[model samples]
Target: MADTARRTDDLLAGLPVPGARSPGQGERAAGAKNTARAARSRFMAAHGEEVYDRLTDGRTRHLRLRELVDAAAREFPGLVPDAAQLAQESARPQADKDGREIDQGIFFSRLLGSPLAGPHLMDAMLRPTDRALRLLPDFRRTGFADLGSVTLERRGSAAHLTMCRPDCLNAEDNEQVEAMETAVDLALLDPAVHVGLLRGGEMTHPRYRGRRVFSAGINLKSLHAGRISLVDFLLRRELGYIAKLMRGVLVDHETSWQSRTIEKPWVAAVDTFAIGGGMQLLMVFDRVIAGSDAYLSLPAAQEGIVPGAGNFRLGRLAGGRISRQVVLWGRRLWASEPDARLLIDEVVDPAAVGAAADAALERLDSPAVVTNRRVLNLAEEPPEAFRAYLAEFSLQQALRLYSEDVIGKVGRFSAGCAAPPA
Candidate 1:
């Protein structure tokens, strides 16, 4: 493992950083690329394929992937650039810094794009994390689990997974991502739970005090402070709980040739608003119930980052033109608007959201709901398409995370000079 790790580090280190070279460095860049390719060939000759095959085989594949990540992290501490480093790098004027994140992103990108490892990587991602598994038994027994930034409660046939983070208006950070995935795992793993429901907890923010606000998106405050990571937060999120919500947990080490997910239908209740990442999530839900006055937006354009899966999925939900308007032009959709109807299935008064959610859950908890959902998902967005999207998304998002525009936008948002789209 140590030898494999060392060789892997050398391969990654030799790869030329994307979008970093000056205009005059084309020749040098080509030379570097050739050198990196040769290094990769050498690494493969030195047992790269054997390492991947051994690590991603059988029932313990996911655990082995975890071990590989840990080993890589230890070998190259900067392999997972923490939020602070990201923020500092973002503040720089040029997007020329060849930070470790770029290399790490390339490493994972190549891995995911590889035929031998891509399917196994997807399976590992779909499987619940060790922490989530650890908390499952307790949650299943008690029907309630509090995962710091998120909570789960089993109510009749429904497992309600609520996002908390009142201090940040339910904004997502690394901690929130972990907790949310764990809660999602619990909701799907519980045998008694036939349906899963998601909502935001009440916020303490002055504007929305004592009221549920679905999500303010990617926690700009944390991003500005440099608390998020490329792998742990960004890649883990899109591949982790978010994917789980769409495809559910993989029950075995079976190949990707067959569908064997233990998935349940999910309904999201949009209380106040769903912004950025929050809106990205609604694309995967079976049903979305929103308050009449609630709104949704994907301000990825303004934020200078790609909204997770929104680019690929939103177009299918809201049409290509509207999707471009929302993702590229930062258009906001009010729940009561006709344009919003494409995304929201039901719109109710704010006070009636609880009743409406309960009713929706009851309706969704049918014997064939999961089967129907699987059929619909397979037709609309197959697993292969999703896998390919992420293979590219991983690299694109990593580049955007450290761009100068993104840093400036985050800084302005953090300083309260810019407001979320109206």
Candidate 2:
């Protein structure tokens, strides 16, 4: 673990900072606007000219993103692609002989794989989209890349933040998280947006088709390949995005202070499952509208990594004993389970999830949700508990990142998401 902690320092030192905006760069965003290819070209010029040549060179048609990443990995060991806005903006989608278009997903895969992209990805995900920042809420999706995956469209006083990647069971990679964080903040900042309905899109998989899976957790393929770094995982997740959720406080030896004042009511519509980090996120919601068939768990113990903020949040929501069974014993809690039921405000049929969530939102006075949540935090949230837990979770998880324990379980764990129950 000591050695692992040391490696984290050396590894992250090379990663790019996520949300920094260079004054001079906006001047460059103009030339790249013509096409994705041009955006990608200029981006590469600013970041890696050699990479640009190899990608654009006639040797490789660069059809699928996976192929590009595989080729880049083979050619440049530990090479990090420049997916900066400069690159992303200038990039134009390319199709192979098959006519399948290539998007930023390739450079994104490599960037996520590098671990350098984590901080930037995390920070970028939390900020409002540039267009969203500059323009009105009505025009948020104007030119955003991530909105295609998890869209945030305004719906009557509430912003509907839906997870749209059914193929991956709504699993979050840097891309999804970035999209989610941006969407979340958009709702938080918008004056008209009083409530948020967090939900998932229809699944197309045979076993789960037409069903909405809340989220399968972090993208496991990226995890299996070790593209996501530990600090990046802990910071963006446990301590960063998830932590900034409410007005909870972070007390220390010196002083106690509120985490972040900017907050709004978030009501998660759990149509199916909220496993792993998906379940971890539930603690921050004002209310959870789970489907009757919904299942929940924090399988970090099984996955060989300490669960993120789930440890603290779950313990707070469901009690310490139940959370321990989960964080330690890999206990799977169904919606009907006593421990699970305690946290779930309401459980309705799958078909009624939409109505139930909106109904719940309608039942509450939006401003009151925020006020009452603060009241609940005062009563339930222990001083320095979350901060202390994440401190430990991040350090130990960093160790788990390089541990044989995780490497062995990742294949089984990741594949299990799409598999039918035995």
Candidate 3:
């Protein structure tokens, strides 16, 4: 565990700082008129002419731009190809004999934004063009690169769960959701993962919701146009996968379930939005740290959808009435809401959200095992069995929670509509 903690710390140090970039780089790329020119200039400025020539020389030898950037992007996340390479890749036909040269445009487009021509530009580059080109990167088609979804970094007795999806606003499409379920299943199966923290990046996009994004729920971008058609198929697949992962976690509990190893209490602090599937993940944690902006909402209703399988889990944790109110209406509920007060233990200003979460985590009693057992027992069964449930069932409680939703909905609406539309 000591070694694991050290390694985890080192990994954090090595990972590229998110949103950290040279000034003018992002503004240029996102600019309506100068995006392409900016991307090209930025590429040259960052990679000296010497390196550019070396790359082009290598490319002439049939090296694909995707292959080169994917190698470099491991260290530099936002880097792009040179203009010369981009033009050549785009000019090469789909049936070109040289696979690497022709595919460069596809790779560059996916990493950066696809041209205004279409989002599938990047997908076409990296995948087989025959069947894959016809189907955009969605539920029906997946990336050829077998990118794993969840990353686990063992720290002392608890393993920190890193929910990584660098693209698509951290959205949980069918593939990402499957990855998260697998990570949790691993934690549950391995008694060593006594605690877990589910989290998301602050700036996630292409499927962004305003300026904020949360891991609490699924991002709408991941769902395909025909997502409704495949609900049953997706549901069955997820259930089977999640069940197996959970079974693995619970299997060895009878013995070797030592709990005193971790010196810290289990906690998951949600930074920004924790909506949709992200909120479902929060339920799996024992203690939650929420930010002022960290209101919970189920926007699926706005799109004429329900949370589906995750609904039961949420209802089990929050009182059934409160859960239904949130999901059915798809309204945002804040800390002041009567039901929200009962649902979330603490709410702090955005400035204090992180520190507050750290404080809450530091105060929990340990042996760690006892705390976890209590939480699972409290949350696992239907809320009806707990004394907490009775308090939640009161008509007075329902009115207050619902009232908060109304006040928040009317008073706290966005000042203006989103630019691209959600």
RMSD of each: 5.7, 15.1, 21.4
C-alpha RMSD between model 1 and the true structure: 5.7
Candidate 3 residue-wise lDDT, 35-129, digit = tens: 33344335534543333335446334222223445444343333333344334433532221111211222223222231221112111222221
TM-score of each: 0.82, 0.64, 0.46
TM-score of 1: 0.82
In order, what lDDT does every prediction score? 0.76, 0.57, 0.41
Top-scoring candidate (lDDT): 1
Q: Against the true structure, whose TM-score is highest?
A: 1
Q: Candidate 3: misplaced stretches above 4 Å?
A: 1-148, 186-192, 204-212, 225-248, 252-266, 313-321, 336-338, 359-365, 368-422
- C-alpha lDDT of candidate 1 relative to the true structure: 0.76
Reference-based lDDT, residue 365, model 1? 88
Candidate 3's TM-score: 0.46
| Candidate 1: Cα lDDT at 327 | 88
Q: How far is candidate 2 from the true structure (C-alpha RMSD, Å)?
A: 15.1
Off by over 4 Å in 1: 1-51, 54-60, 63-66, 72-98, 252-259, 416-422
Note the clash tally of each candidate.
4, 14, 14
Residue 383 displacement (Å), model 1: 0.9
Q: How do all the candidates rank in terms of TM-score, highest first?
A: 1, 2, 3
